[model samples]
Target: MDRKKAAILALSLLTIISTDTVAPLVKQISASYPQVSSTMVKLTITLPSLLMIFFGLIAGQLVKVISKKAILAIGLVLYSIGGIAAGWSESFPGHLILRGLVGAGTGLISPIITSLIADYYQGKERADMVGYTFAISHFAAVITPPLAAYLGAEDWRKAFIIFSIVPLVFLFTMIFLPGTARRVQSDAAEKRKAPIPTKAIQFALIALVMMIIFFIVITDLPYLIETKTGISPIVSAFGLSTCTLGATIAGLTFSQIYVRLKKWAIPTSLLACGLGFLLITFSGTSVLILGGLLCIGMGIGILISLIMLVTANSAGEADSTAAVALVNGGFSIGIFISPFFYANLPRIELGLPAVEFNFLLAGVLFAAAGVIALLVAISTNKQLNLPHR
Candidate 1:
């Protein structure tokens, strides 16, 4: 691979490094911040997603004014700063501030990556690269979660602090690499060349809806399972690890399937995701929950791979980065809203209360994503005239 491809490859590691520190250190963070409620701590976890919501869109415009390479470099540096600052946060507000900055870093990298890939390659090669990129993300996912748990056991501070080094890796790779996205001639030239497609807009909406449901399930369901089923931390982490395994397998496989039928990707993934949620809502035992997670993770894997694929196809060259940024915004929105839904769910078995409604609410969103997917299907088949279903 060339220098630009090398930089693109490094983007996968950034995802792993960013979230790996959070889960294992949750207990320590809860204990350290005496003034913060568990719910408030959840907010801190959701903070990046919240920032992603706005920044994904803002990042698109930002790329217009500055080089994508510069945005990524600055974002990664800030991300390190946020991670280091949060490691020593003495107050809830301080942690929140650091998390918001970390979110900014996240907002910059992923979309820039997708856009960069679109800029660099085309035809079958583009499809293959995107698939491999997603596979790397899953590989990182598998390693990061467990390693985080181990490191947190030894020293949680090191967990967050260690990730600060990842940006250095991304920055180094980017510096050594050549820029892939060529500068357009005039201010209006790039926009005219890469005008937003109707398909891209619809793809983004579907991406947003699917992510909203995925985060809702992942964020709220784990705690519910722990408290309701009396599962130990090790067991809980292992089970969630299974989700990563499923996601990994699917990420690699879907890239091939998507290449054969580019237009149908979003709707197909959405239907699968909706079914996964139904499985989760009704899942009563630990085994059932694990199965549901597997299905859900598989769906998510497919969705991520396809969304980027669709973005590349629809966006003009210059605007492609912005389109990817918009998809990132959708991702952030999902995380941001999952908690809001998580909070409102009826409490589980409070001695006086009935069964928990968290998964049930999550089920509704998952199923709703399916509805959105079907609508997208109708619009796609009719507007694009490609028989998306």
Candidate 2:
């Protein structure tokens, strides 16, 4: 790959690596702080997401006034510092605070990466670059879990060390990433205030729902495997890796899939996810669970790339960063709320174990969503075929 693409791809890894890298350590971190509520412990995983929502939007505006590279560098510095410091924190509150810093940093970084891709590449090239972006990030996801599991095997603190790589990425950004001038808007254009495209908002909402469904695997699967199969947490972590493995494959193939599937792509991806969740619900063994996760991964992989492409294309250059940030922020919100949303559901009234029930619920929702998407796709196709008045 060329230097610019390589630098962007490396930056991609930083967006997701911190969360996935620390996921395996969640249970262990909870064990260390017995007085803390389970929800609080899980916040260690989700808190960054909460911060990302606000920071991402802030980043959208920042890019208008500052160079994208400068914004990225600042975020990297904060992310590296916060993520590494959180590992050594003795107090749970302090740890969460640091995690917030990490999230804020991520929020700042996330939109810039997508906006950069939208800025630099176009048409099929842009679509392919988006795919490659997700592919590289998911590829990192595939590697980090097992490594984090191993590193945190004896001490959960060690896993945070993964964040240290941010410094190298920062150096790469400075050395390789070309600087773009700040966006200069005319006074008339500024006063005119072009509205964000409605389609962008629609896609962002879709992204929100998709993320809620997708994160069920990430936030709940380890506990599911541990409780149902009595497997080592390492195995559970591996299950997480399998999801990303499938995602990586999907990312690598997204261009071909999009070309062929066209309007049907979203529905097909949703159905695949629904099927995967059903497999996880019924499967009795770890192998089956991993298989299910892989399927889920593939579905989400295509779905996310599709959303990014459509949302970017819907907006003008001036609105690109904010539009993309809206979708990414939706993702963070869904992820942040997932555990609480699933946990609060009346699983007891439904007469099912929590984890299994969460998976089953997600399966049913995705299946229903798939049906809806199919209908919408058919309607849209029919509309396009209608003669113009």
Candidate 3:
């Protein structure tokens, strides 16, 4: 409710705005550019993700030399310009170039937002802020894609107009976020700094896998719904939105969930995702598919927040930004690789339809991962001599 929290939430709203808004417009954009390959056209959605990994690490280092607010401002400006201009581009290459700029901007912005939360809040309050950040981001995700699909119905370029909202977030950042000085560390201070925790690295890897699974819903569900049920793509888009709606619900309630689940939260979330995917695998109707996606979204939403919180807490303040960036970079990598990874699976050999096989594989993977996480938690609790919750 405070200006600082508001500013943070406003920035959170932009995190998914850059890439997701363009997703529904991909087919239209490809159609408009008859000369370009479908692979290149698809990059309109994934290119930003590839660039995010590169620039996200750069951002982690930038925080050491510049104020986070200043970095954020620069990123916002790039995102606004690149995202808006891409819509107007006449050439396919030009559009891809602009999208890369948007990705760079997002890369810089994403790590800083989580690092800022770590810098500004602590303990349960920090956990709550992380939850709100996920909640706000998913809420934006739920709203933006449908709006973009509607706008791009006639002209795909118009969907880029969604990025025009970046200026409003920029204004909030400039007005409400208090500026901090560069994080200059002396040789002695640097020596005293602990190495990034192994747990943080492990969690970053978990984040990578989680995004790979979660993006199955994002990148594949619309196609699945349309092909399976012969529904309009707009309805497919809405079906996708239900996934984010579920995530939004999870984000809003994560604090209480964490309070009750503690370390058990990770496995519980993975199990929820597995069950959701299983529902999608077996369900025959569009409405049932949407319900499955909602469940998947809730599980992924909580899983990501838990990863961010645990990773942040694992490192010293000086190293937190870099640690957070690693996890975010993992997320971007997962996003970039998901479509190809799923598309190339040996589904043909298995004698199943692509969409059905994808969901079935996802369900099995999530369930296996959940059991692994439960074992890890049990082992960790034993090592710490802690009571099982």
- Candidate RMSDs in Å, in order, are 4.1, 3.3, 3.1
Candidate 1 lDDT over residue span 1-389, tens digit each: 67677777777666634653475566667777777787778766678777765666666777768877787787777777886787677678987898888888877777777777776777667777777788777767666666666767766666675675665776676686565375354666547456556777777676666665567554555555555544445446665566666677777776566655455655666666666666655555666667777777777787787677777767754557777777777666766776665566557563421223555555665667667766777776543211121
lDDT tens digits, residue span 1-389, model 2: 77788889989998778688888888899999999998889898888998998998898888767778999998999898998999999999999999999999999998888888877777788888888889889999899888988899999999888888889999998898888633444563562365667888888787777777778788777777756765445456588888899899998899888888877888889998998999888887767777788888899999888888777777765547788888888999888888888878765566667788888989989989999989999878542111111
lDDT of each: 0.67, 0.83, 0.81
- lDDT for 196 in candidate 2 is 67
| TM-score, candidate number 3 | 0.92
Which regions of candidate 1 deviate over 4 angstroms?
Answer: 180-196, 228-234, 259-268, 278-287, 345-356, 364-389
TM-score of each: 0.83, 0.93, 0.92
Which 10-residue window of candidate 1 scores lowest in summed lDDT?
A: 380-389
C-alpha RMSD (angstroms) for model 2? 3.3
Q: In candidate 1, how many Å is residue 142 off?
A: 2.3
In order of listing, the candidates' clash counts read 1, 0, 0
Candidate No. with top lDDT? 2
lDDT of 3 by residue, 1-389 (tens): 77888889999998886777777777788899999976567788888988988888888777767778888988998899998999999999999999999999999999898888877787778888889999999899899989999998999888888888898889978999878623334563672355767887787787777777667776666556655654445457687678888888999888888888877888888988998899877777767677788888899988888788777777754657778888888898888887888877765567667887898889999999999989999888532211211
Error of 3 at 172 (Å): 1.6
Arrange candidates by lDDT, highest first: which order? 2, 3, 1
Residue 27 of candidate 1: its Cα lDDT? 62
